[model samples]
Target: MTKFASLKSVRLAGAAAIALLAGAAQAQNSPPGAEMATEAYLRAIQEKNPVLHAVIAVNPHAKADARALDAERKAGKIRSPLHGAPILLKDNIESNDGTATTAGSLALKDNVPGRDAPLVKRLTDAGLVILGKTNLSEWANIRSNHSISGWSAVGGTVRNPYVLDRSACGSSSGSGAAVAAGLAHLAIGTETDGSITCPAAINGLVGLKPTVGLVSRTHIVPISHSQDTAGPMTTTVEDAAKVLTIIAGSDPADPATNDADAHKTDYAKGLSKDALKGVKLAVARFYTGYSPKTDAVFENALKDLRAQGAILVDVKDFDEAPIGKAEGLVLNTELKADMAAYLASTDPTKVKTRTLADLIAFNAAEPKEMVWFGQETFEKAEKTKGLSDPDYLKALADSKRLAGPEGIDRILKETGAAAIIAPTTGPAWTIDPLNGDNYGGSSTTLPAVAGYPHLTVPMGDVTGLPVGLSFIGPAWSEKLLLNLGYAYEQATHHRKPPAFRPTVAP
Candidate 1:
């Protein structure tokens, strides 16, 4: 029997128990008002974060930032809806706040960035409080193929709030768990492939993997420039839209975002319960069938979509042969080139390891970081010929073309659909130290590699664990995806706060 099935016997009573516990927890931890005061949120972080291991460091100036925003609001100079809202950031993203931007690795424990990343500046300018930096898989899960998703030497392992022993699904694990556990109003998570959406899905939150370049990646730790972007992870789709609007704009330092201002808008204004009306959505069933419980949840979501006035068209699968074969080559080649550039930009005094080679050597010298997994992926990336190689060029062209124009774009054009829907991923698995992540099915790759927009919303729970339904579209289709996600979220109201269970009891 499958894991989902094995847990079904205890699901009904377990869910009720979880709900009661969650309600009590929330009541005990509730803030003074509708919007949590930044001080109260920080106190909660201090009380709850040790057990959760979600936050790596608390921003020493967060209380002051929140007070400043409150003063602006009282002065009738409110910058945006996010004004005074507490926000957590993934550790890989740099901030001018006193905390170091460690990618959960000890080598950069003192890598305190002098300036905020462009995206961080945009959000702070709009008045969001930088609560703290959250933990992530060391080096964004690129150091080792067998690495634990939420384990890092700096922050230890991030525990799932729903079930403490289960995987939180990195490298956005801490961001997802923090928001779900109400440690903050919102959090920023960076994705390359399933990093953002997978964690969001497993943790029962809304996550958007915006089109690459829509959000500036300047100053973030690099994996692949072709596929990396920071996005919002929130308990509500409306909150995700609000955060996205603030961060989506042109950045002079990042040339890829030169045209971003044209595509940017107040995404929150586009949300409506009737937004799904007259919309044609295609069902991408390719990612289903991994877990029966997940598929069941997805099927019910389709029904909810149809009830919301959406026309659902069935598209079994898209041809993804070329994308799978060339993706590794593109990522490996870019990692060597992009990481060197990012490291070069860091303060030499704060960062001792200056390049990919330097990082590999540092890991070898410090064996504690590799106690659970070897640096096989890093070794492979180090051996790759730099970006100028013919192999790298061919792989990049093939992967992008197939994942974009010939894959997601073709399906939308041929099927006359505005967006496609699929299961974001299966439920969170047991975190195994002996092996690595036992990821089941996932639908993030096509949109991730194609540089398209993908949003995951809480669909339902399977044996007391959360699952997410994904909406994907062509580049710059974030508005459409958010609207659809908002509509579905309203109709179903599937999200439930985590109960912080020890495990799935039988």
Candidate 2:
């Protein structure tokens, strides 16, 4: 049975508005063109956004851009299967469109560069419409340790579409919620660690954090230069693969992506339903068993994989304490350095928070910025001596060594497994401002710290909330992981559209 059938149907209250708009737009004699599709989404946002707060700004040029793409199609040009499809950019990613890349902060509300990030350029070149920018955790959730995941000063909090009171986990929250709710076909989200995958899992979407250097991190707001990368967040693994194909190439401005051109490929073409058959997958048992409900769902998913002829290997004992300890130091040290560099790149008049100290003072003065939480994390980053400091350097080297060579690599070699599997995270927790995020479990650190690829696909729900199955692989293994995820996704058919229930009692 399809997993969704067994799940209760709690229909969204505001869905009629979008449904009516979709029907009215496509009810015409001719096929619904890009213009019509853009219009429908624009109208959908108007009717549904007040409740969800998913989108920060709608692109003023979206209709005009769609019309242009339609004219091109009429003139015998179709860039790809996704040509003219509307996609949202997480507010941290800059685009040439009129929308400001605010990073969900009131401080950078007017910090519009009016230039596309290299990845955004690639998407536009492929004829994808820039529908708008979506909200996010303020400053990508780096300001405070006690920060709320989906709340932001500029765009407000992003509500999970599955259950309105649930948290849409971190940084990429709006992008995840918007795509899951059908606000857009896909969205681009940046991740320093679990930012992309967490929100994607909680919101019941497919999120792929590619090998760090595979996609350029040129114009997105900074967190950690060594770890940050932009990736696709979509409802389907195929859509994520398609977006990765377009965006995976070298950018001259980003030194990290120097080898990207050599590694890039048509990722979507490599997918096969039989890819998982006879493949040995290492199950990261340490990452599971946090929530019994989530583990139960994962066990059923494992059964589905086994039924498909995949071999599951159990390798349970690995200590993750050193990696976690080292990662915090590396992130704090790099954030101070990378943030200053990015701020310097911005126009001086538009962005006044030119240094970490400047941002700290701004938050101190602005009541809205500090009303919900404090900027203790930012202050700690400011106190770090420099990226060149001995302790910081030691932490950086130690983290990479522990997470990459001694970590995922050693496990794979010992098990002779193609990849590692884990529960991406537990189901979405309640949105709480008083105490901040209460995570049940996460398997994001190994892949994230190692700068390897991690793909998360919806496995099933815990109660009324969704959880994701994670595939973790070595560097530049995005294609392999995608194929594996696609195979599992096709076999299970697990993804379900959100019901937008007010809350789940359990």
Q: Choose the strongest candidate by lDDT.
A: 2
Q: Please report the candidate that would top TM-score against the real structure.
A: 2
Candidate 1 on 387-503: residue-level lDDT in tens? 899999999998999989988888899889999999999999998989988988699999989989999999999877999999999999999999999999999999997777789
Clashes of each: 0, 0
- Which regions of candidate 1 deviate over 4 angstroms? 1-36
- Model 2 gets an lDDT of 0.88
Stretches of model 2 off by over 4 angstroms after superposition = 1-32
Write model 2 residue lDDT over 1-506, tens digit each, in one string.
14323222212322332243234333433343677667767766775678889999999999999888777766667787677778899999999887888888878988989899999999999988899999999999999989999899999989998998999998899999988877877899989989999999999999999999999899989999889999999988998999999989999899999989888999999699999999999999999878889999999999999999999999888899999999999999999999899889898899988988998998999999988899999999999999779999999999999999999999999999999999999999888989988987699999999999999999999877999999999999999999999999999988898887888884
Which 10-residue window of candidate 1 scores lowest in summed lDDT?
Answer: 26-35
lDDT of 1 at 384: 97
